[model samples]
Target: MINNMNKFIAIVGSNSNKSTNRELLKYMKHHFQSQAEIELVEIKGLPIFKKSADKFVPQEAKDIAKKIEASDGVIIATPEYDHSIPAILSSALAWLSYGIHPLLDKPVMITGASYGSLGSSRAQSQLRQILDSPELKARIMPSSEFLLGHSLQAFDDNGDLKDKVAAQQLDGLFKDFLQFVNIFNQLNNAKEINVQKAKDFSWDKD
Candidate 1:
């Protein structure tokens, strides 16, 4: 019964105002409130990362990156479009990956909802591979897949999940993710401290 108020940001991958994926993210954000301060985000405000080399990135994209960097962990909730993530989310990831790895060694959780029978499993898989690339190297949570299939009927009018099983799964996923993030952050912080100490060590003869 540990209580840790970690800050987290949820990224929604859809541009549609009526997207079920967005609603799914909202529900997950509320469910994680007890364990974290979760803020749901969207990529609609971010512009395409690159048109030409060394072009100025928009302030909106920078703002989103800042929020992600400030947070303890990240949750990416998206909708599968043609067996892949949507363009909006892709663009947002591009912005985050520009010139540097925004997710380097950062804790990341990925989930998605879709109308199809497999939900967004394919999309999440693709996202996982992308996050695991040497360039990004995000510490992704494993074995806790939160894929909500048949999402059109997965929620009630109030946007809360209707399936008790799904709710339970999400609860467990959130808890596990929180623990994972905490452990990783602790280790990363310790490493940073050691590195700082090493940098300040005196090798000169006084």
Candidate 2:
């Protein structure tokens, strides 16, 4: 019984204009076009990541973090580069971990598209591990992995998944994900701790 209407921000973790990952994200947007409000976001505007404490985090980066904080769910569509996640997505996670944790306990889904047979499975696996690290904590649904392999042939000019079998399976995955969102939301609220406990256990990195 999934009744909650969640606002999800879809982020294609690549900066290239003609990215296959972006196309995949577009297909996902169309897949659930009427079910939820899906907004495609980019990370090109974010300033370069700083490692030192003296320098300040970019305002644009902060705003993006805030946006993710406010959203009910997140979708990260990444391309596998060198058998791992790209720097763009990883950099964004580092900043989001700082200045308060917006990604903390939020429901997220990771998908990837690639020209290779594995799709972005390697990148997604790495990303899932990163999500659980102290740098960030996002509640990732353990559902079907939407790997759009051979992306060039898998999608059409309009970005709709052309493969009927893959499309049907992904459609089912989305329905389950929406339900996962509701359950995850409940757990986040129900497990919220007292102020002292929150401060003691919270990985705000403050």
Candidate 3:
């Protein structure tokens, strides 16, 4: 069971630089500032995933996996490139599929902003499809889509979310996301308790 005091959340993005996606994640962190510990995962050092090298994934990948395992929920903010999620995000997700499967049954939410008319909605949709693979086991938040358009002009040079309406929409999305995650956590705790009770009964019968 996750202690309310110890619960943590991880926010991930594709770019290592001052990306708009990262800025969105920063805003998310601020929204949750008083509620939970939010850790931003850096994908800069993660290597390209290779199937043959299952025995030794890169240290960076391992670090990310550990963080995912420790996190109570995950928020991803990714950019669109060619109507798809960035290659770096893809690589990280691919690497996470091996061994530990940190995303399995984990609560996840996705949001993004773009300079184009479609925002990063196309890329976010592609990522949702990828995350829905049977192997992932993610409890995806359906209502948490934040597709901010005109990304370059949406924020000031200081990286604040400039659009008041967009900010409010994002806030609402985060509130829903928090409720979903809390319910998931409760269900997980109940399942664990039931399993422990069953195990205890079996031991007594023997």
TM-score of each: 0.86, 0.88, 0.83
lDDT tens digits by residue: candidate 1, 1-206: 32357888888888888888888888877766666888888888777656455646677877887888888889998789999988888887766765445577779999899998898998999999888764456789998779999999999988799999989988888889989997887678544444344335332424
Please give the RMSD to the true structure for each candidate, in Å: 7.1, 3.4, 7.2
Which run of 10 residues does model 3 get worst, by summed lDDT? 197-206
Candidate 2 RMSD to the correct structure: 3.4
Ten residues in a row with the worst lDDT in model 1?
A: 196-205
For model 2, what is the alpha-carbon lDDT of residue 58? 73
> lDDT of candidate 1?
0.80
Q: Where does candidate 3 clash, by residue pair?
A: 105-137
Using TM-score as the measure, the top candidate is 2
Residue pairs with backbone atoms closer than 3 Å in model 2 (clashes): none
Which digits, one per residue and each the tens of the lDDT, describe model 3 over residues 91-110?
A: 88877765546777788988
TM-score between candidate 2 and the true structure? 0.88
lDDT string for model 2 (1-206, tens) is: 12455789888798788898888878778778778777888986775566665436778777877788778899999899999988888887776765446777788888888889999898999999998765466788895588889987887777788899988988888888889998876676633442224335534246
